[model samples]
Target: MKLLSSEIKNKVLESMVKIIDRERHNIIKANKKDLDAFNREDQALFDRLVVNEAKVDGMIKAIEEVRVQNDPVGNVISDLTLDSGLKITNKTAPFGTILIIYESRPDVTIEAAVLAFKANNKILLKGGKEAINSNLILEQCWHEALVENGLSKDWIKLLHLKREETQEFLRNPSEPLDLIVPRGGERLIKFVKDHASCAVLISGRGNNFLYVAQDANWEKTLKVILNAKTDKISGCNALDKVLINKNIPNYEAKLKELQHVLRRANVNILVDENIGNILSSENKIQEEDTWYEEFLALKIVLAEVSSLDEAVEKINTYSGGHSAAILTEDKNKAAQFMEQVDSAAVYHNASTRFTDGGQMGVGAELAISTDKLHHRGPLGLKQLVTNKYYVFGDGHVRV
Candidate 1:
């Protein structure tokens, strides 16, 4: 009976969604009863999202503004001609359903739903264990939007399940999962890539890099590294390693300055013995934390390379194929690093922290596509749709 009810709810939601745009701003403020439901049911979730409610609202407002100002990616391209008297054009279409399985990041629940909703796709969100309460709150927000607009909430349904359930879904692909985008550590994404039968988008982990080049301005380098690692140590964009040139002037003092900053921020520093002597204090970085570790906290690895070539090789070898940055005053050297390092977002004279879909000017974010295939960089609304050939022929079959 519950399954039957869910099917009914899904049909209702799909029908309503197909007609929502006719009314401008269909999602309005919720009524008193709805607000009460939000408050009373699962209050722990309220604690999580409510703490950052204003910030979430700001993101929503920004998304809505972008939705209004920007044009949709889909348009009928009808300018193809053939010598055999046939016109062939192409059209864009949305993926019908997108099943997302992500780890405990509350904001992603909202992010995925908004992106899917805007792209005219149905979404089934199954957030991992740590964010059960937080995900519930975010799911409720979408439900309110649907319910207040006189629509069913199935458009963005949250599959209430535990970690085991998600593993089952990945291992057994009987469900109608059009695409599965995994967002978490190497373990999570690897499980999905190995088990899931459907097409998958690897939102690979961030073993990102930052290089302090020989010509880099010491002051700017300090500010950039701090911003890169300290902006939000938990984010995927944060720098995991700092590569300094061995031949630079005041290298010891510069290294010491950064060490102090990392220590003050409460980050454990793993330094090579050469650079270890320069620091004011001694704090060791564990072997596990030193190599390809996304600390997501106050932590960094310091390594001294003999030359620029060595620095590039180290990054290319150890990088998680995510964002990488080089702080350098020398334009030529920066360009060289950008070209040599293999990652999705190669930044220069800037922090790797800005490697996000929203920051990259997409109205809605899907995830960073780590797999190099149909999509590679940050997945956005455009990546959500694909092309289909629309061949036009008047009384002309195959010649």
Candidate 2:
């Protein structure tokens, strides 16, 4: 892969910012076409498909944020000299080419490309058919920026392939795929993993869990739970499960209060047997599979746990390894829960909504990776590059 100078990359980003601003109307108009064609029955998917003026502004902001950040290529990671006069240095390098398959969201077409291009990696976007119009317009904006900066449009591209074609391409990609990121639900991730020949980075599934410990501040716990569950139901960090300690003070009353709060918010609740006895009117979970499901909707499951260990075990077993939180006034207990949750981002008395790249101070991100290899959390500009070693040796031979 050809290395691009930081100046040139930033120039492209600057050009992209201006182009998106100028083409804001066209972008919105194109997105309207997608929204018109989409099925509104899937509220979460529809929410993701909408690209209003605010969404356009968000895209511009994402590009600008990445533009001002430091370039992530060729930075020294480590340097050492052996006794045999051999000098070795490790430096950050781009992953060459990255393919990210995502669903519904058009903003990803902007965020993913900007991050990968700024890091000097070419990006291939395979957005869902539902957002085709939005993605096409966004891809054109990217191309204009690249061309303005004397770079190949191939640096950022959108793949327009059918389902069968995508499957075949993943199995035998026409070009080398240094890495693949499946930024969607379990089915999509599984599809990519089962077919892709390259390294696949798992992301986007979010059956996140939050624990309310016995000593948790009731007011703070309620506030965090409301925001994490409803702030943006379409978000990958949205809370799907809440485990309340059975020994908490006034457990039945608190569960009733929770049911009232959730009902007022119009959030559908599912409960385990223990919680069901208290909130009898609420729906009971029908299958074990629901525990592992990432509901990108206004739905959540409330269950009871006897101890902190049980809470931790349940989250680790059922969560998507995305985000988890604990609400507790006890510092030691909060620390224990945060340490044992085994998610990408574990929080103490904070909402799982904070797992986002922007919220976590990562600016714009490619995805919130759940994969432990290569990277685990936000795939930001700095995290996009792998490491390369350079050796300088003169008249040195290994025995």
Candidate 3:
């Protein structure tokens, strides 16, 4: 975290206080196309992006949330006493500027609103091509709100342009980027990690594993499988691989039934050697890439294995250290599965798709913490913070 002088910090606070009051519904009256400073292809690409109105409204509310005496950092967090006649206290502080690059999801724009506001930091958001239009509309709304509050509208930046701009922001090697977080696929994450000038936190990738128990319930298994694969195939947290223990009777039939549900949805299903079936374009599983890929479409990799141990071995080998799920009625087996799978989240009986910040009960999320340190799993408000300590004493000097 870059330490800030008290004057600059107060200026930022004053700016935020001014911006917050002006940003509500200022740009809602205009068409999203009005902010066409960028290209049309950008808007066309983002036109297909999926964002709920309620989610947009939530972003609108988040700006106001900062002014509502909310926990927007700098709050008194701790106070303590020591026997050496010392009084100690701890408080929160901002992490300076935050730059977040993510795949096309308008929801993230809303997330950025709450995140930058609550964290008391300036922010730049560069969304994926899929969310250009949605993002533009949002930026316009935000600009109007900020201007309404008597603040510079540029405090929140929306870098809407080519992919090159994203790299340019990351490649500022000499000037420096305090922190760079990439919230897209492995490819984008790798690109940012390789090129970023600042410390990179692998916000994580969404690849999960699920293994069936020896005596799994067929109906429940099918339901769980459907929800995991089809719930939101485009999300990083979607389940990617499934293992069926060979010890389970009629494993093939159960797997096939699950395949039937997927195939009916036109989802691409890939198979490996354990499937005991040949691969073709008919949704039959094949190719090792299936395990490593997050299709963001209706697709999954199907594999069969001998035991929970084998399932664990496969996941540890291929998982992106994201989330995984398992379905079984046996307590010991669930415990073992949970113990062995090295994922950010290990689900029992629930869909691997539910391994999300929103589903975990947080009102909102910045991104999935695919990284092991700093932030992991669902990234809520708590993850946006760090604590600092202060101590006081009367004429006490250390020897």
Candidate 4:
């Protein structure tokens, strides 16, 4: 809970950047062990588990980004001198200790720790068992960085607890837990919420939706859809559902064109009743639950909407409150959809993929938060700290 000077924190991050670069080969080797032991059936999970040279470079870049940015803690929010001769100043403060439970991604082990440590919060990483080896090596790198900067290894610890033990720890944490971020699917979020006795920030689940308005530019719609859905299937910002306005010019033909494009890209499509009629050969959505599903794969759902209101309503109801987009040349409709859709990030003629932290210019993020309590979008360095009121009074007392 001690506040570290910005110089020391940046020094640690500098060491981390050099250390990660030097240990890139060993890091890749450790990841190879995880990749070999992992089941390849879940392609999305498999892709997330891979930590190649590019990923290591990305890790180094993340540290560098956070390192150069302004330290988030102690920035003054507001200062006021009351009429009663009292001075009160609200300033940013670290959250003390944070626990982030995530799956597959070993980069979170670095990104989360760097952000939290830089913000003066001790982070406890609870990565999935599948990436144990990779995370262990990454944690070792973090420890080396911390020790090199004369900081405690406890500043960035990794929790190695099993399912039942995690449940118990969540229910009755051994140490103080200021904030808990569950960065995974619904099951994982539910597990953390059901047990954790601290404030929980929801992240990771992304049943993102995109609406193609009747006035949409056909070429742009197709491009956005293709990029959002297929560009990176493992990303949480990846598009999962597409709602096309039925009144769009040449609706049936556009639908067929979309199907063709997706087919060429090897993306499997599921359609609602109306879309099913047009794309008869494609599979129809079997259950209503399909609307709420986050397809973190080469899969997407195509549905029809009669109006912009309907598209907004459907997205608000079924989406994971992550990201939503409207493709329309009409500024009015785009503004309406952007205003009405209940999501952390809403786009106007842009791909839902822009919901990412780095893409949105937040630098290295802890996660893309879906929760609305403290934050609702990218959990970046600035978003990691809460506020504290510092009061200075001349022997004043409330009457």
Candidate 5:
């Protein structure tokens, strides 16, 4: 793929912002078709699929934000004149073509494509069939933006492949795929990893954990818990597991109080044996596999940990390596926990919900990557590009 000038890329995004604003009505109408055909049983997914007036406004804002961000490509990372007089520089470069496989969330069609285009990468969106109509309309907007800027429509594409065809395509891509981001559950990540010949970035799992240290402020604990758990059940940054230190003062009373609060909020509780013994009415985690699951719903698991070490160990062992939080008044303990916790984003005295790109000041995001090889955490415009080494050598022969 040829490098696109920053002005050209921004022009496309500018066109996209205007086009999306003008076609807001059409976008919503197409989204309505999807919503009408969709089963609302999966409340989280249904929430993600809906494109209301607010969502349309959000899409326009995303493009506008990406347009203002500096171009990520060609930024020099390191420059040096070697001993042999060879001047070498490592600079950021676009990742040629990227394929993102996501479910629900028609907003991704706007966010992901905008980031990739801004960074000069060709994007191939593989959204779930549930959002076909919504995605098609969004793709049309992208094509129009490209054409309006006199760029090829090939810069952005939405794939309409079935399960079998997708698997085959991953195994044998019709065109080169520089990177593939699987932005859904573990099943989707595994599917891409197992079949895709290119680099695969794991994303969108929310088996996130929050630890309530013994020294934590009880009021703050309850507030963070409620916000992280119920604020946005469909978000990948939403909390799913809570580890309460058993040594906390008035531990038994706190456990009962927490249970009451969650019940009041209508969040289903799944307790481990220790907590189950205390919260007798709540359901026990019957399967160990439940620990590894990302509950993207109004559900949470409450478990008791004897010590901070135990909590850290459990989080690292079972979490999706996305985000983890510790509530502690002791800064030293908080720092220790943050250092030991193995996750993309670690919080101290804060909710895991702050792991979001926009909230964390990264503006619009393509995905919250859980992979460590290339990037971890929010896949923002700056994080979307790879690096290339440019070497300029004299005509002298090697020693």
Candidate 6:
């Protein structure tokens, strides 16, 4: 694969920023078509599909942010000289081609490609059919920017394939696929992992958990819980399961208070057998699988735990390994919980929603990777490249 200079890539991105800014009305119109055809029953997916003026502005800002960041490729990671006088250097390199399969969120068509292109990687975008019109227009904008900057349209592509066709394509891609990232729910990740012949990175299944210790400030806990749960239910970092200490002062009263607050906000509450006995009016989870579910809606599960160890154990066993939080004033306990939980991101006295890329100061991101191989957090520009070693040796014969 040919490595593009940083200047040319930044030029392409600059062109994209202008093109998207100019075509905001057309983008919104195309999005409106998708909105009219989509069923709003899935509130999360519906939220992701909607693109108004603010979203268009956000897209342009994302491109601009990536355009200014230092190019990720060709940076030397390490330089070494062996005893035999063989000089070796390891340097960052592009992944060649990257395929991102995502559902809704047409902004990804801009953010994902910008980061990949800036790092000198060709990107293939496979968005859900529900957002076809929006994705097509966005792809057109990318193509125009590429052409204006004297680049190939092949650098950024939107694949239009049905479910069966996608499965077959994953099983047998005509071209080499260096990496495939599935950025949606469990079903999408599983489909890609089961069928893809290349490496697949999992993203966006966030059955995030928050543990409220007995010493936690009730006011702070309530505020964090409310914001984490209701701020944006469609977000992958949104809170899903909350475990409260059963020994907390006025534990029963606090539980009732949480129930009232949640009900007032129109958020549905599901409880385990223990919490169900107290909050009998709410729905009770019938199966254990509910613990493993990621509810990307206005729904949350309340479970009671007797100790911090139990909360840590339960979260480790059932969480998506994405994000977890512990709410307590005790620094020691917070440190213990943060160190013990096996997740990509852990929070102390904060909402899990802070696990996002932009919020974490990464600017634009491809996804929130839950995989530990290459990366375990936000997939930012610097995290997109792989390393290669170049060895130079004098002509010598083996002894």
TM-score, each model? 0.82, 0.99, 0.81, 0.99, 0.98, 0.98
lDDT of 6 by residue, 1-399 (tens): 998888889888888888999899999999999999999999899999999999999998999889889999999999999888889999999999999999988989998989988989999999999899999999999999899989899999999899999999999997899999898888899999999999988885899999999999999999999999999999999999999999999988999999999999999999998998899899999899999999998999999999999999999999999999999999999999999999999999999999988999998989999999899899999999999999898994457
Q: Which regions in candidate 3 have their CA more than 4 angstroms from the true location?
A: 1-48, 51-72, 75-78, 129-133, 160-165, 173-176, 278-287
lDDT value, candidate 6, whole model: 0.93
Residue-level lDDT of model 5, residues 204-281, one tens digit each, is: 587999999999999999999999999999889999999999999999999999999999999999999998999999
Residue 94 lDDT in model 1?
Answer: 63
Candidate 2 yields a Cα-based lDDT of 0.92
Which residue pairs of candidate 2 clash? none
Q: How close is candidate 4 to the true structure, as a TM-score?
A: 0.99
TM-score, cand. 5: 0.98
Of 1 and 6, the candidate ranking higher by TM-score:
6
Give per-residue CA lDDT, model 1, range 1-399, as digits (tens): 011232333343343333332211222221212333454343323333232435455445534533543323355755688998788888766666788887655667766666666666678887765555556655666676677656657778888766677778777754577778887778888878777878888888787888888888888888888898888766777788888888788777777777778778877787766677676366555464467666666668888877778888988888888898888888898889899988999988888888887688765577887678778777876678656687778899773
lDDT (tens digit, per residue) of candidate 3 on 131-222: 56666766665565556555566556787658776677677632335566687767888889877877677877666777887888878888
For candidate 3, the per-residue lDDT at 16 reads 42
Model 2: CA > 4 A from native? none
Q: Which ten residues in a row have the lowest lDDT in candidate 1?
A: 23-32
Better of 3 and 4 by TM-score: 4
